[model samples]
Target: MAAETSFANASRRPRPLTLVAIVLLHLAAIYGLARAFAPDAVASVEDSVLSTITVTVETKQFEPPPPPEPEPEPDAGEQGNEGRKAVPREVVAPEPRIVVKPAPPAPKASSTGAADTSGARDQGTGTGAGGTGTGTGSGNGGSGQGGGVATKPEWIGGRINNARDYPIPPGGRQARVGTEVVVKVTVGTDGRASDCSVFRPSPDAEADAITCRLVVQRLRFRPATDAAGNPVAAPFYWRQRWF
Candidate 1:
């Protein structure tokens, strides 16, 4: 009976140790389940953090190359000569011209005195008192008349012989014995002689020089008028005679 009681005590003590071991095992199982749930919660928190952070990558763009330069134009001289050729053209005949003979000149007139008078009229001259005369001379391929009408410059007539008073230079009388001097006088609008030049120079220098001086100093004129009757400067040619 004592042996049976000792066995019962030993069994009871083992039962207490087993119960404690079971309690420890149950705590270990609970800890394993909590660890597993904690990992899921950590994953959820990391999802929010990852969603808040955004990363952007920048891309580079490349530019295309520029177009090439254009070629130069060709020179005009280097072009072909097709447009420069001479073209054949139609020809027309010209009309013929006629020739006619000219009439013969009239016969010459006879009678010396009548012929002399007719010649004088043709020369545009009239005899003056004392056989002295004035004439409408021809010059410069035109009439010496002013404004296209026959006219002559008049001298204040007298026996003064205009240049007689002019002091004769040495050898003047001998040099100018047979020669005549002609002078050209340019009259101004004011009716006064503006210039005097030797128109026909004489062999004698004294005669040429005296002719210009006598005309410029002693000659006066009525200024010629135009067709409109306006007074104008006219050129007058005068012949000087010395006795």
Candidate 2:
């Protein structure tokens, strides 16, 4: 019975060395599992911490200094007449001078002679009366004669009648045959008519122009005369009947 009790106690109470070996084996298994998963856990923690963390930089700025104030100007009233002074001057008078002039001399008188009356008494009786009457008659005859008078311009009738055949104006034949055109002709000092203008115009402009041309070509005149009988240029007018 004692031996059986001893065997039972030995089974119930394990050996210290075996218990130590089991704890060593369990510790070794836990160390191997921690070694295998530590790298992945450390990598995952580093990724989360790096991804969630942020860094901010602050910058500082300096402000500019204020501007300087301008200096004030000087007052005008305080320095108005600081260095000015008045000076005195003297007045001088000029001396007067006198001048003299001579007077003109008077004219001298002339002498007169006496008259004789012995011949004057003899002529006053009868002989002087007949001589005075003959002198009066001669003076009256000289006063009656006068100077020559000046005359006006005169038209040459024969020359004007000869110039009746004037040129027929353009379209003049179609117009009424009895159209009278009057023109003023300026006669030069040489007795030729120049610068003729139509005094009376026809219905046709060409006829009026041609009439002036014909008058200047065909007409002639005796120029006017001055009071001294000098021939001068004058204007005269005449009429022509269109055929």
Candidate 3:
């Protein structure tokens, strides 16, 4: 009964050592919680974890793939006969033969004279003022054949006569005396100058242009004729000087 009493008393009153131990335990638990929640400790752990991770980005330099090699050309001899079929030969027509006709003879001229009126009958000959011929034509009775010859174009007025009335243009007045301009005039078969161009220009452009205009407008021509006496267009060259 006395031991029971003693145990009961101990149970009722807490021991100093036990109380101290309990208080120490509570303090240690609070310190541990504080350390766990500290910013510095969390930052340290994060830094350690981040420092261990390494991110590596590898870049590969890629050059464009080499251009494909060109295919070899086929041999000329081997491919020459490939995919070829026989073509029909075209029938060649014979060239036409050209026949040239001779020109007709020119008519003979007749003469008119007193002696040519004689009763003697001369067939192809004509007598002139006083000679031996069939007809009485002019000049000494020389039988003459008609002329069918080609002739060059002639200006209606002689070159000097045509240029006599040329007036100096207002623009050309400033140019020095004898400022020359050469021109080419194309004479048409109708005896008119159809086109003109300045072959050589003068100091004054207006003068050159006006010269061509006047040549084309005022100039007239006796058209050239071929051997058959057919009139043909021709070109005439002239030069004018400003005085």
Candidate 4:
């Protein structure tokens, strides 16, 4: 009875011999499956690596392009290719052109003598001549009136040359050629016409008219004053005509 119980327990406690053998068999099967299938799978993977075929068509070594052709030489007579300039006849120094910087108007040629009133100059009629210096100084075109300042004329008592003195052409409807007047009027001290008229006139009627209009519009003068500096009441003459 004791022997039978020990045998039963031994049987229940698995024996190592068969277990080890069974384990070794299972490992061998696994190793065989890995070996046989792994190589084939690796081959398939390697096939995927070489996706495209590179067929080399080796021919010959490459060569660069040929050099460009040289440019043609130029002819002697013609400049480069076209017409050439003629040689200068002689060397001439450039002239010294007097730019005249407008010369500040020559300081009005300081009158070493008294004012010349001979040519149609005023008679000093006590009407209202401005004064000895009746000329409007260099006009600045400013609209402001003078501040009791007196200005002298370039030629006192002298009548500015006018063109209206000539009789208009007496031909079919003789066009009334207005004067192109630049009257250098000399206003007397009496405010009356001492000496006044157009300065120059143009032979052309139209041109003369324009000048006359401009000069007339520009006429301005302080009435001639008496010795007391009072404005004289007289008609100052403004020569009117055209060159």
TM-score of each: 0.34, 0.32, 0.33, 0.19
Per-prediction count of colliding residue pairs? 0, 0, 10, 40
The reply for model 1, stretches above 4 Å from the true place, is: 1-172
130-240 per-residue lDDT for model 3 (tens digits): 223333223433356544337766767533323223444565434335566777777778888767887768777775676677667666778888778899776666676
User: What are the Cα lDDT values of the candidates?
Assistant: 0.53, 0.52, 0.56, 0.41
Per lDDT, the best of the predicted structures is 3
Worst 10 residues of 2 by lDDT: 113-122
Over 1-243, each residue of candidate 1 has an lDDT whose tens digit, in order, gives 999999888877757778899999999897677668797876787778755643221111112243487697443222122222222223322333753654332224333232211222222223222232232322225344535423434344222253344455576444445556666777776766657887677676665776577667766667776677667776776665554
Indicate the worst ten consecutive residues by lDDT in candidate 1: 55-64
Error of 4 at 212 (Å): 13
* lDDT (Cα, tens digit) per residue for candidate 4, span 8-123: 99889857998999999999998778768797875676668643422221111112244498697443221122222223222332344776444322222333333321123332
Reference-based TM-score, model 3 = 0.33
The best candidate in terms of TM-score: 1
Q: In model 3, which residue pairs have backbone atoms overlapping below 3 Å? A: 111-135, 111-136, 111-137, 112-136, 112-137, 113-136, 125-134, 126-134, 126-135, 128-141
Instruction: Give the residue spans of candidate 2 off by over 4 A.
Output: 1-152, 157-174
**Candidate 3, which segments miss by more than 4 Å at Cα?**
1-149, 158-174
